[model samples]
Target: MPGYKTHMAGAAAVTGVAVAGIYWLGFYRPNFESMVCLGIFSILGGLFPDVDTDSKGRRFFYGAALLVDIFLIYKQQYRYAAILGFCALLPAIGSHRGWTHSWWAAILIPASVLVAPMVLLGLPWQPFVPYYLATVLGYFSHLILDGKF
Candidate 1:
């Protein structure tokens, strides 16, 4: 398992590669909106996994990030974020070492992310698929660099 320094360095490298890959594949190309969207997702995605940390400030940061996620993506969950977060802390506290480092999240998280807007935004299948795919690619890089050891 990679440590925080290793994870961060690897994630940065992967982020660069992902952006380049999207540009080269013409998924991004000269599209300014796509690039900007990817950038936003990249920032959020990169920090998300590590938010569930043991450090005092990191824990607070994690809680804040969860609130942000709920506020931005699922406001219905916003009210529950802090309360649920408090609950989430127990098991995490019990099993801090091997818990967050799970590979299962890679498959599950992206799948939900891709489907989330179909339910939330009521977007048609056409634009939703490619847009979600792009977002997944950007987000998955962070998961991979998380090093599920």
Candidate 2:
């Protein structure tokens, strides 16, 4: 299995190619903020599985999750932020290589974006579709690289 750094690098590389493809295909306008957010989500997805382990990866993941949760709280989305915090802390109950590294995690984590934005903003799913795709791609790449499948 590749290390966290390797997985992140691979995800970043894949995300770059994907962003280029999106631009090349003319599916959407080339927007810097959207592309950058996509890339960040992809990288985070790559490292997500390791949050179950007591490693640098887990620390980083929890840190980022907590930061986001804090932002959510500031936005007055208390219930959503609580859910986020709870999910982020879930892996700690297990030693490692458990649910966090499973196939379902890959799907559910990215899929959460589908519901979260709608809950927060009452927006349609169109805007989050690209981010969802990027996250799934990066997450699957990590699992494959780790020989989980």
Clashes of each: 0, 0
TM-scores, one per candidate: 0.54, 0.82
Alpha-carbon local distance difference test for all models: 0.52, 0.83
Q: After superposition, how far is residue 106 of candidate 1 from its true place, in Å?
A: 1.5
lDDT of 2 by residue, 1-149 (tens): 68888999888888888889878998766589888888888988888888787666788877878898989989998998988888876888876777777889899878877887798789898789888988987887788888889
Q: Which lDDT tens digits does candidate 1 get at residues 87-144?
A: 4464355344344344554444445446656655776655544444544544455557
Clashing pairs in 2: none
RMSD in Å for model 2: 2.4
Residue pairs with clashing backbones, model 1 = none
Residue ranges of candidate 2 with Cα displaced over 4 Å: 70-77, 93-95
- Scanning candidate 1 in windows of ten residues, the lowest lDDT window is 93-102
